[model samples]
Structure formats: structure tokens, C-alpha cells
Target: MDFNFIGTIWSLLPPVVAIALALKTKEVYSSLFIGIVLGAILFCLSMGTGFDGFLSHLLNDTVGEGDDAKSYGLIHCLSDPWNVGILVFLVVLGSIVSLMNKAGGSAAFGRWAAKHIKSKIGAQVATIILGILIFIDDYFNCLTVGSVMRPITVRYGVTKEKLAYLIDSTAAPVCIISPISSWAAAVSGFVSGGENGLALFCQAIPFNFYAFFTIIFMLMIVVTGFDFKAMSKYDERLKEWYERNGWQLDEVSDTKLQIVEHGVGAKADSKKPKETKGAVADLVVPIIMLIVFCMTGMVYSGGYFDATSANYHDFVDSFAASNASVGLVIGSLTALILTIMMFVVKKTLKFDDAMSCLIKGFEAMVPAVLILTLAWTLKSMTDSLGAAEYVSGVVASSAAGLQMLLPAIVFIVAACLAFATGTSWGTFGILIPICIAVFPVAAPLRIISISACMAGAVCGDHISPISDTTIMASAGAECKHVHHVSSQLPYALTVAGVSFLTFVVAGLTQGMGLMASAAISWISGIILLIVALTILKRIKCKKE
Candidate 1:
């Protein structure tokens, strides 16, 4: 009965099935569940086990006491400390957002922004600036930027899909490039072979084409008002829907927008935001406090406060050692408590109303939480099926013979694996070690290849429907998850194509050393992006 399918071509079936079904049906929850089930079934077949084995793989009680005896099931995924921490952070963050909305902090900020930012472009620029500034963590960036900028973007007729796209593009791209961010930590921790992981990560930053180019492309689209066909079609539909309803484009409120975003439901009505005494500080202060507390929590988690710890008192080292999930949970909870206290003390919200946000916040995030749980379970299923091992083995086997074209190859492979797995750090773990093993520690090509791994992982994570960051972006914008994925695909793919070409140039020119290869690669990337954008603009013009 043994199928011998684990770590083979068949290992990819579950994710491929899930992704295809989700994209086709536009039903994320069911699609992910089916994938998880398929993975468990496959595992059972491979191991020559029966229904009992399938059930164990599906939702087991086995404790992962050691690496050899590790269990990957829906229950185990949910029970993992890191997973629990993330879920806790999401609930706290959702509550904080609810409290802000009920206290009128969001409304106040929107009104304030309305006077200062008079155009759609201005609003988008502000959003980009805010996103760039919050580079400590992508999850925090996604939710915080969406909560703060949603009102202004809505006022300016920014479609919820577009808002989600903006939130998503900025979240991981900015995080991947920031030295003090969680992504840097993840990448640094993945390196081996007698090299300084952090130092190598810093070296790889310049060659992370997708991260930089995605930012560049976002700015271009924002500045030029150019939209690809998919996004443009959505824009037209939004305009027509607004016009049919006899609402002025600029006057559309966030509440009515939500109705258009996800159908007419009582959920939209109940979540209709109310403005308290309009004070910008009501929004600004809470956000500032969140950032401060979160940063402090990250450092503390890294043992910055412990005298006996190696990372003690060193900001960068502490950040590199920080546990993002734990830090985010701690920071978000403290911020939530303070925000509720501030609102109640100021009479902006009654204590009872403030307490009510607990349920409201959890309610708001239920959809995201459900999607995330399913996604996590699906990932667990893939793990049980040896998806990572399969991908790593493939990369390791093929990499030695593909030196000059290796960076581009790595980028594409990493992108595909990450896209299927819906986890960038997992992709990093699989590809980075292979890259390290293929080239000498100080080889310039090694650095470029490593950068490609980081870039491709972020790129795939950026566009993947099941990625938590993507889900967070959808939640943050309060957009339909499917809509966000569809609208952002063309845009993300455009950048990915350009990034792929840039990695090719880097690989071809590695003989010139890191600086020369990087310079050539960046210059070529910019030219290619400009050419691509120009072509897209012309197509838009012709369509118009």
C-alpha cells in the first residue's frame, strides 16, 4: 500500500490543488480545508496507514517531543506557541482598531487628513510614507497602515481592492529591506557555513530586487495613475456602482464602501464607524504608543533587558534575535489596554462601550482568524508531505551546474515554492541553505543568490492567496480577500517579471564583484521597469 510519494513530485499536489481551487472558486476557507485533507490523505497512503492514520494526520494529539517524532496536524498547528501568539496578536490588534473606531479616533484622523491632503495621489503618498516608516514588522505594518489610512483612501475613491494592494505591497517589501525588521532576522538566522549571518544579510540587501522594485513600481503607479486591466476593470465597476447609487465619488463613506466591498450585510451596518470629538491626537497618540510599545517589546523579547544575555543593550543585535510573534503579541496587548483606558478616561467612549470592543474586535477579525487557521493547517499538511524537503532536494541537485544562471533560477524556484507553501520564512529555510552549500562563503554570486531567495520569497508571499500577510492586508483594508488577490495579481506579476530579469543580470555579471554586479543589475532593473510601465500606460491609454 506504500505509495512512496513523500518528497516526490506528488508532494506538490495539495498546495497546487488548494491554490487552484481557491483562485477558481473564490472561496478561501473551503479550498484550504480541502487541501489540508488531501495532504493528510496523501500522507496516510504513503505511510501505508488507514483511516486512523489519516485522522491522526488531520488533527492529532501527538506532542512533537523531538524533531523525529514531530506531528503536523490542524490541532498541532493551532497549538504551537508561535501560532497561538500570532492569533493573540490579531485579536488584540482587532480590538484596538475597534476601540479606535468607536472612540472616533479614526474619524477624527480622516477629517484632519481631508483638510491637509486634498487629492487621491496625496492620500496614497501618505499611505506609502506611513508604510515605509513602520518597518519593524509586516503584520503590524499591514494592520496599522490600513486602520490609519482607510478613511482617507475611501474619501479619495480608492477602491478597497486597491487599498489592500497598497497595504500588501508595502508591508513585506518594506520589511524585507529594513535592517531592523523581522524579515532581516529571519534571513539572518537562515545562513550557515562559517559566515556572519547578519553581516551576510546586510550584504544581500542591495541585491533584493523584488523588494526595491516593488516599492518603485508602487510609487510609479501611484504617481502616474496607471492601472493594469484587472485593476482598471475594478475601478470602472466601482465608479458605475457609485454612480448608480446616486452617491458622489468623493463623498462615499467608509460604511457604504464596505457594503460595496463585501455585499450588503448587517455586519457592515453594525461596524458603521462613529466619530467622537474630532481630535487628531485621538488617532495619532494611540498609533505612536503602539509603535513605541511594540519596538520595546521586540527588543525585550530579544533579551535586550537581560544583563546576562549576549544581545543585551545592543539595539540591532536584539532586533536580530527578537521573536516577532511573541513581541507583537506583547506590544499589541499593552497598546490595546492603554488605548481603551485613554478613551474611557477622556469620555470619548464609555467604559461599558470600551469593554464592548473586546467582542467587537474579535468579531471583526473572525474572518481573518478563520482564514489564517486554515492556511496554517494547510501549511502543516504540506510539512507532513515533505514539501520543503522535496523543494530543497531539487534545488540542491540542480544548483551546482547552474552557476551563471543560478540567481534567476533560484528566484523563480523560491517564488514557486513560496507561492505554493504560502510562507516566506519556510521558503527561506529551504532555499538559503542550498545557496550556502552551493557557493563559497565569500563568493559575490552567493550574496546575489541569497538576495534572490529573499526577494523571491517575498514576491511569492506577496501574491499568494493563502499567505497570512495577504490575509492581513485584506482584513486591514476590510476588502474581500478574493478581490484583493485578483486585483493585485497583475501588478505583483509585473514587478516579479522585472525582478526576475534583474536577478539574471546580477548572475551574468557576478564576475565583476558584488558592487559592480549590483550596480549593473539595479540599472538594468530600473530600465526594464520603466519600459514595462510605459508599455502598460500605453495599453491603458488605448483602452481609454
Candidate 2:
């Protein structure tokens, strides 16, 4: 836990090990635990002791002692309020989704959307729009978008890998650019003093090339119906599977069956109730409630309701100060209760059936929740290793002569750190403070540089197989985790390449006005992305 003396190259070993193993072995849990153990060993070695000291660090520090001590490991991480809240929300949302599936809400919406969306393009485009609207949090966006759209997409013959990519692309990228987002809250918290953090964040949105260009790239792919690199091969395989196995969803499921409603001509049993009340409005109303309640909860948590609090009218300030984990839990719980009542009152589900959904939903989310818990604990280990301090020291020491290229350099380093650690929040926490310190308070380049940090963090997390958002995206899409990662890598990298170049342009144009510079850089980046993707499309065409 005491990281002062151990902030060395050894500090980065855990995440590096975890990432490398995930790549080589295609497993996440054991790799993460190994990294945690390695970090604990590093803690011991830094104490200038042997195996006995290593055991103590692993047992007492990583796993924790009795109760009173300020422990800094897995036990401490799980007990933390933020982690607990998000875990609870995941379970609750899972139950709600299960209920929707059971009540025939999902199937009914699928039937409804089937009438309107006639092509693959419509399916993909609609998924993107839905992803953009759910801008509160990436986890919610990933799962909800996947669950709600999965039926429609399958109906239209969209591949699970492609669906996963769409879900992943929209979740983080949309949140990074949206002002009223948890990503915004995390970014603004990095800025010190009485600075209008939200204002600066909004200003940087235009310069967030990775986030914006990822969206552009995604839309172009969906519109054009193209795939290249590893994605191309996977896309072909999926087509073959659909052709050979028919339109059943089982080929994509990993042992566990997807939750589907009781229906169809020959498949429907006489005992099943009619799905009269479960219309598209059933899905629409609950999602609307969740979004509204989430916003209300966030503001309330930020003391917007406190008459004594100054800046209560300033919604941006309240949003910047709100506790996202607590707010999301509150919002999700309210939405769940409302949804249950609505279902029961409409006679879509009996009280006993709705109650059973609680357990079913928890079962569905166990994998995601387990992975998130591990990811959070992994973050705790990285913090205990002082990954932030080490990154900060390096950035501070190197800032003097590289002013023009510093933003690009910071972007790359942040990307690598996030890719290794699989966490954008942790990466931004480590890098954003360093950017703020290196440049003047009011400097346009300072804001540009910070934006680069966030954009790059999102970009890396987008590609990382171990990233929690990526994991959730895979789960939501009901795709193989490895398949999702492989298919999404090329798309993420293409955007990241354009984003890095944009940072270079932004750095060069720092003397220019912020808005003008952002405009120029964004235009250039979008052009580059389109060009690069077109080339890939051409290659795929030639191969075909």
C-alpha cells in the first residue's frame, strides 16, 4: 500500500503481465490474479525482504487484515462504496433485462422494429443512434443497446462480432464527447482549483478526434457494408454459419442459452399467455424512465436539491461533482421498481414471475459483475503500485523541450497505459494531472493536450481485449470475447491512427484560436479516416 519507494518500472509489471497473458492465452481471470500476485511480490521485494515478506504482503496487504487497517488490496477494493454500487446496478439492470425478455417486451419490440427496419444498414444505424442517446455511462450503454438491439440485428442477419463492435464503438466514444456524462465528471475532476472544468471539457470535445472519428468510421462501415483485416474473415465465417445453421442464435452463444420469449407458430405452447400488452412502448417507456431517473439521481446526489449549497443552479457544476456510481445505482433501482410495477399492472407478468426475474437477472449478469469486480481490484493494485505517480514523474521530467510534440507523445503513452491496464478512468487519472501541471492554466495547448489524453485513453480501451467496456460489449452482443476483440481491433486502430495525427496537427496549431484549430484538426482527421477505411474496403473487394 505504501507506494513511495516502489514507484519504479516494477510497478507496471502487473498490468503488463496481465495484458500479455490475455493476448497469449485468451483468458482473463487467471491472468489478472497473476498480475495481482506479481504486484504483491513487487511490494515485498521493495521492502528489501524475502518470500516471507512476499507472503505477508499478499495475505495482509493485498487480501487485507482484520478490519480497522487501511488496506489496499482485493478485500479493500470490493468493500469500497463505488465498486459495490456499480456491481449492484449491474445485477439490477440484468434482472430488468431478463424481465423484459420474459414479458415478451424484447420479442415484441423486435417484431415492431422488424416492420420498419428493412435492411442491415438500418439495423446498424439504429444501433448507433440508440448507443448515442444512452450517454450516461458506458456499461449501461453497452448492455442495454446490445439487449434491445440484438433481436432486431439478428433478424436482419447482422453478425454478433459486428454488433459487438457497434456497441463498443458507441459506448465510450459517445460518453467522452457528451458534456452530461460520467466520463465528463471523471475528466473534470482532474482539473484543480476554481476552474470551470465543465466549460473546458466542452471546449475540448471538438478536438477529441479519436472519439469523433471512431463514430465516423463506424457509420461509414455500417453504411457501406464493408469489412477488412481480421474482421473480414470473421464476417465471412459468420455468413457461413448463418447459411449452414440457419438464423438460430445458438452458434453465437457460449454454452448458456439466450433468454427468448415463448412464441412462434409451431414453437408456441398453448399454456403460454398472449403477449398483448408487451408492445414497443413497453421497452421505450422503461428506457426513457431509466435515462430520466439517472439524470435526476445524478443532480440530486450533487446537492442540487440543497437550498444551502451555492452553485446549485449551475447544472454543469453539479454534474461535475456528482457521484456516478451512487447515482447510477439509485437510478437503476428506481427504474427496476417502476418496470416491475408496470409489467404486473399490465398483466404481462404475474407477481411471482416478476419476482423470479430478480434471480434470473442476477444469473445473467454474474459474468459481467465478476469481471468488473476483478477489473476494479486490478485498478486498486495499480494504484497501490503508484502507477500514476510514476507516469506523472515521467511526464513532468520530459515536458521542458517537447512542447510542440508533447501532446502527441502524451497521447501515445496514455494509449499504451490504458491498453495495458484496460481502464480509461485509471489512465486519465494518471495522465490528465500531468498535462495540467506541464502547461499554463489558460493555455489552449493545455486543454488540447488534456483532450488528447482522454481521446487516446478511450481509443486504447476500445481496442484492449481486457477492457471492461469491451467485455461488456461482447457480453451484450452475445459474442465470443476473443471474436469481438479481434473484429474491433482494426476499426479502433484505424481511428487511433487518425487521432494521433490530429494531435500532432493540434499541437502545431496551438497558437491558433481553439475553435478554429479544433475545426481544422477534426476536418483533417475525418478525411484521413475515410481515406484509410476506403483503402481497406478496396483491399477486401480485391480479395473477394
Candidate 3:
């Protein structure tokens, strides 16, 4: 028999095993590798191949010498041009960050912020605002916001867990809703069948309940001083430690510095100079230049600057066709070169000192790079096993009988898929096409359902322990990965629950005009979220 697990229930095992083991063991690398091996084994069994087949599926790529030829596995993922570009961008960005720190730009900014930002609330709010302002890409937002706000937040006694949550809450949520972002470009690329993808994405933004509500929920958390029990425990521990040590609120002690610098890839004690002639401009100029060059690179890659290319178009159109990986690599490399020159020229760092940051930066990003590589490989495993096919088939089968409840159902399915695979872009690639296939172009429910897909994907990505964004946020804030995941879950779920209900309302009211339906559902979502938070706060108060 020609055996295969393609589009079957068994295809889900690899990612399921990966997610389950990661959550239980709290060890990502081995868990992901194990899942990859299992998936390869499954593929071998399905193909009726022997040990060689397993080896090929695990570490090698196939070029189709026969009918059974396929392309997947870890080696293939590492060799992929897109993945390499992302890796390059990460390394370059890491070098830039290290240079900034070595030149004392970060410390200067920290001192500047501490002097001006008076309260804990102000620091937290500033973090959120900065996160929101960097809406071009989530990866960029996570690292930038973390580096910029970490010192200020620490100075105010905000827990690392809390800072990670703030960075994460704004990252994907903001990008998913912003029309000028890399996320919009990704989403637009999926709109097939002669549809205007960018326009559709804009129309759907108003209905992205999860993304919008998450931002609101974060602000509410900051304003109301509300913390979920998991997060509160972290807060309480920090408070007790401070009390025990008699540490002043504003003091940046060596002990605290060690805590902030721990496990996030950098050794703060060795690399940073005691004194340097660095100012806020050293930090601010590079970041601003990075943004400018990155945006230009994205548009250029999309052919906006290439009049001879067939894809040549205006800024938005070009960006829609742009390659994020390529653009980021190009932009970050340019920014790194410029930043090095700036630091060296200003005498903040010697040429040799600036050059040394490249190594330090690479070292700092090793943890993130390893996690990302494994995550990508794990995703490759699921691809080999046909997990996306299985999920899509299931969704297609279930769509026939449930019209009004469809949006909510889609949201749940998308969330589960993203949570399992730990890839929001992959989730979008899977579900958004299915959504377009299920509903007519003119159908009111089409927009709502598409919005649900995006919301659900972001929701899952936000909470998934293995998600790259989650990993980046932890790395950015210098928090333990497990601590960030465990602390952020309750808050993400709270918003997710409200989002699900909102999707239900949106699905039911699809007969109404788009504006009316969005307004009604949005208002209902706000009320429900506020009520849920109030009740939860009371419960927390009672527990205290």
C-alpha cells in the first residue's frame, strides 16, 4: 500500500507533541528536536521507507529524483534564502544594539529617561507608547522597545515579567492593525482571486477585536494597576526582595543591574565601559536611520525604485509586494554600518572597540537565534507531516453547516493552529486562503471572518511558549522565557475570551452594513471586556 499521513488527523501529532512538551518541560530546544525527529519518523513510516528515509527527512533535502521527492527538514530550513535573510538581520541588529550599549548610548538614554519620567505609571505608559510608535514590524518593535524601556522600567521597580508583557502586548497587536506594517504586507499577499488585498485588510482592521482590545487591556492594566494573579505573584516577590534589601526605588544597584542583564545573552559587567562620551543622539539617530532605511529597503525590494521592473508601483503597492526578510536584512546592515561609523567618529568608541561589538552582539543573540532556528525547523516538521492540510480540510468540512457562528469558529481554529505551530504568518497563510475560498468576495461575513483569522492568529502567537515574538519579548526584557509565558497567559486569555465573544457578535450581525456591524460588535466587546476585568479585579481584591 502506498501509505501517507497527508491531510489526515495523524499529521497533527508533531506540533502537538512539541507544544505539549515545551509547556510541560519548559525546555524548548530538546522538545522541538524531539518533535522534529518524531515527525521524520512518521514520514518514513507513511512512505514505507527505511532508516535512510528517516535520515533524509530529518537532516537532508530532497530534489525529486522520483515521485516521492519532497523538500523539508532542518537543513532545508537553514538553507532557505528567506530564513537566512532573517538570520542575517538578527545578527546585524544585535551588533547595532551591542554597539549602542558599548558606546554608552543606552546608559545615556536610561539616565535621561529616569530624570524625566517621574513615576512607575509614566515609565509603563512610555513603554506602551514607544511600542505603538514602532508599528512597522513586531520583531523590530520587541527588541527596540525592550532596549529603550528596560532601564526606565527597572528604575521604577516594574518586574521583568511585567515589562515583557508590555512589549509583547503591543508588538503583534499593533503591527496586525497598522496598514503600513510588514504584517499588512503579509496579509495582503494572501488575498487571492482578484481581490484588492490591501483595501480588504484596511476594511477588516476595525473588526480586529483581539488586537484592538489587547492594546486597550494593556492600558487598563497600567491605569487600574490591575495584575493577574500570576503576574501579581512576580510583582509581590520583587517587592519583598526590595523590602528585605532596603533598596531605594531610584537606585540602580549592581545587584539590580545583574538581574536585568542575566540570561538575556549579554554580560553587562564586562562589555560596558564605566564612562563614555555618549548621548541620547547616539541611540536615537541609529534607530531613526534604521527605520528610514528599512522602509526604503522594503519598498525598493518590492520594485518601487525599479522603474524597469514589472512590479514597479507606488509606495503602498510596492510594499505590498515586498519581501520582509530581504528588506530587513538590507536595512539592518546599512544601519549597522552607519551606526559603527557614527560611534567611531564621535570618539564614543574606538574603531577596535566598535568592531568588538559585532562579536558581543552575536553572542547576545545566540539564544534567540537558536530558539528561532528550532522553531522554524519545528514548523518544517509540521509542514512535512501536512498539519496545515489537515487543519484546512477540517475547517472546510465544518464551514458548510455553520454560517453565523463561522467567524467565531474560524477564530478558535486559527488560534489553535497558530498556538500549536508557533507561527502567526504560517497560520495566516493557512486560514486566510481558506476564508477567501469559503465566502464570496462581496459577502459581509467575508471581511468579519478574515478579521477573525488575523485576531485569532495574533492571540495564539501572543501566548504560545514557542512563538518567536514571545521569545523576542523575553530576550528583549531580559526575562526568563518560561516566566514571561506563564505571567502573560492570563492577560492574553482574558482579551481572547472577549475577542471570541465579539467575533460571535460580528458573525451574527453580518447582515448589517459594515460600519454598523463593526460599531455594534466593538461597543459590545468593550463593555464585555470592562465587565470581565472589573469582576476579576474584585476577585483578586478578595483573594488579597
Candidate 4:
């Protein structure tokens, strides 16, 4: 596809406006809304619309396009199935999230977790594990994990900024690595159609530098208790709030150790905390059901089961026929309804309180929903304008000896595109086919290249402020979006840099032992950690 400079420029304007507004205003929803409106305006201008026509086009694009050329100016771009699907998923997910919160499931989980998990690092670790556990869907994983883990982390003086970073890092990074995750499904589908898809995926795992390293980096941060410069600012702010308000940390501390040691005083209540029977069961069973149903759905959709002497295709045809979204929607709704019933039946919450919880959950998700809409709108605008394709084409064309540095090139290109689009899946979709077509014969290089694409996509998606994961992370931490972005950038870049270097070495060596490469990556990470720790110590010393 040929590039349209004007279209590209116009398409790029939205994110630029978002970034500018975000930086200047630090109001995430406002920034995203402005970006969406700006994109609509640019779309109108591109179509040569007048002010009235532009307004009409904006409505048409947001709603649906009609057959009229004037209507075409407004709605043609967003009429695509993918765009519509994205919008539906975002809104529905928002509703689901709200329901989960409203049912007191999230609060119950948080309160329950806080009782068991002690120490700041443990809370962060729990957040990461929860993020990893909810791997079936990144959107679900990011928001659900963040919502459940935030209050516990906040109680321990674990800054929301840090919590957001942990949530963001684990969400996409863990999803890409898990075979059954939405991210893996998308990439696997792409590779399956290509030569030796399974082999390519396996080989790519070793070179998924970003995902591997980011996870390690998160763990290191958790273990070492080192805060980045921006994160220190958050820490200071949190401390100031505590000091000025004369908030007694001991009074609010809810950890099991604290409660066991201090008894009633630990809970900020003199009365014994009421234990609802099956409180844990209420949380655990629904999650288990969601997983079982989703896996069964995937298997059914993929046609993996056939008791009769059915052919493989027949099995796949029957089992794998349903959309994944249907499974998620059904699973989330079932879980939410069941949780509500469980709470009500046990008298853990009255019906009215249960309803109130659901409303609060939905309200908590308002920011995420708005940001998601704008992000999707930005994505639609870019895709329609061919911004990603144009940029990919430019990178593919301009790079010298792409065959030699295919892995590195893939990493850079995928990272840039994913960052631009705020979607790893979209980046994978765009780049995987191109990689497969270009590197048809070189199996090792193909694996490496595709892996690089996945890694880069995850890396960029994890770090990009406009990414749904990033937004959800901020919401999870209850931190400012810019604060999360600023605090997390240094850590993300640290991993990105190390991953890039590892990719270079891996590409040059052409599939050197995975252990050796992992060791090298680990050694580099240790060095980064030591340096970070040293710097943090110096800062601490200076502060004291």
C-alpha cells in the first residue's frame, strides 16, 4: 500500500494531541477525549468537509455510516467489523467490570487478600500473580487484577504508581507467554497458517526478550525494594499525605500478621470482624468456573473433541466455531451473577448492598471505559488512514539487509507500531503475516523474527500510556496516568534496552542455547539492578 503523507499526518495528530493534553492537563479522560474529537475533526478535514459536514461526519463515524457520500464522510472509517467489535468489547467489558465491583466481589477479594498478604513486597507479588492468573484475556487480566489488588497494596504504603507498573508489566507480558491467552491465540493463528508454525512459536519463545525480561525486571523490583526516581516522588507524596493528616499507619494496617499480633486494633474496629462462610469460596469458585468454561469453549471452538470417528477438520469445525468474545461475555456475566447470589444467600451482603457494590464497580470503571473508547477510536483512525501499514512498509523498505538483522528489525518495527497503535494484537496481526511472507524459507530466522514481533508488541503495549493495560494499571493503582507512565518508563526502558541487546546477540548467533541467552540476559539484568540499587541508595542517603 502506498503511503499518504497527509493521511498519515492527520492520523498521527490524535495521539500527539492526547500526549500533549495528557502532559499539560494530566487529566487522562480529558486528554483521551480531546484526542478522539481531534481525530474525528481530522477525518472530516481529510474528507474535505465543511464545519456542518464535519459535525455530521463526526456523528456518523461514532455511530454508523450510511450509503450517502456525505454520510460516508462521517461513518465509513468506523464501519469496519474489527472497529465495531473493539467498541462493543470495550463497552461490554466496562459494564462487566462495573458489575463485578458492584457485587462486592472485588472489595471482598481485596479485604480477604489484605488479611493474608503481609509486607509491601508480598502485596506487589500478589498483584503480579493475580495478573498472571487472569491470562485468558489481557483486558480482563489488567482490570480485574488491578481492581482486586489495589486496596491491599495501598494499605501497605505501596504507592499506586508502583502497583500500576506491576499490573501493566504483568498483564500483556504474561498473556503473550501463556499458550491459551488471547494474545497467544492471535499470534498462533497467524503462525499456524505459515510454515512450521509450532516450531516458529517454540523458537520465538526463547527470543521473546521483552516479555521475559520485563517479568524478571518486575520481580527484581519487588525483591530489591528499589524505587525509580519518579516512583520516589509518589512515595514522597504518599508520605506527606500520611504525615499531614496524622494518619496512623498502624491503625489502618490490615495484614494477617498485624491483625494476629494486635487483635482488634489492627482492623480500625474494636469488634471482631465477621467471617462470612464461603467468602473465599465465593471468590474462588467463580474464577475457576470462568477458566473451566473458557478453556472448554476454546477446545470446543477449536474442535479438539470428537467422540465419534470425526476427522480433525470436522472436530475443529464443530468445536472451534464460536467467537472468544462470547465466551468472555458469558463467563464474566455468570461469575458476576453467581458472586452476587453467593453474597446475598450467605447474608454477607444484603440485596441492596450487593446492588450498590455492582454500581460502585461500574463507577470505578468509568475512567477505564472512556480511555478504552478513545484508544480504540485512535486505533480506528490510524488503521483507516493506513498509518501502521505505511510505517511498517517504510521500515521494511528502508532497512538495509533485513534478512541479516530480521529479528532486531522485527522487534523495532513491532515495538514502534504497537506503541503507536496501543495494541500488541493489532501489531502482531499486521507484522506476522508480513514476516511469514518475507521469510518463508528460513525457519530459524522466521521463528526469531515472529518472536521479536510478539516481544516488541508486548513490550510497547505494556509501556504505552495510551494502552488499555496502562490505563487499567493506573486505575488499579488509583494513581495518575502520567505518574504511572513516568514511574514505569525507566524500568520499561531498562528491559527494552537489555532485550534489544539480547535480540542482537541472538540474531547474530542464530539460536544459540536458550539457557546461555537467558543467562546473558539475566547477567545484564543483575547489572542493571545493581546500578539501580546503588543509585537508589545514594538518593536515600542524600535524603537522610
Q: List the residue pairs that clash in candidate 1.
A: none
Mind giving the per-residue lDDT tens digits that candidate 2 earns over 411-473?
A: 888888788678898888788878877888879888888888998899889987668899899
- Which 10-residue window in model 1 sums to the lowest lDDT? 259-268
Worst 10 residues of 2 by lDDT: 254-263
Root-mean-square deviation of candidate 3: 2.6
* Candidate 3 TM-score over all chains jointly: 0.95
Candidate 1: C-alpha lDDT? 0.87
- Taking all chains together, each candidate's TM-score versus the true structure is 0.95, 0.91, 0.95, 0.81
lDDT of each: 0.87, 0.80, 0.87, 0.66
Off by over 4 Å in 1: 61-67, 251-275, 309-313
Model 3: lDDT of residue 231: 95
- TM-score-wise, the better of 3 and 4 is 3
Alpha-carbon runs more than 4 Å astray in model 2: 1-5, 49-70, 245-277, 309-313
lDDT of 1 by residue, 99-164 (tens): 887877887788778889888899889998999999988889999999999878877778778889
Ranking by lDDT: 3, 1, 2, 4
lDDT digits (tens) for residues 1-544 of candidate 3: 6778866888888878887887788887888888888888888888788998888888875746678776787888889898898888888888998898888788789888878998889999999999999998898899988988887898887889999999999999999999888899999999887877899999999999999999999999899999998898888777776666666666755445555545322334654435668899988999998899989888888889988877688898877888988998889999999998888777889999998999998998899999888888888877877898888888899998998999999999989889888889999999999899888888998899999999999999999877989999998897888889989999999999999999999988889888989999989999998999999999989988
> How many clashes does each candidate structure show, in the order listed?
0, 0, 0, 14
Worst 10 residues of 4 by lDDT: 256-265
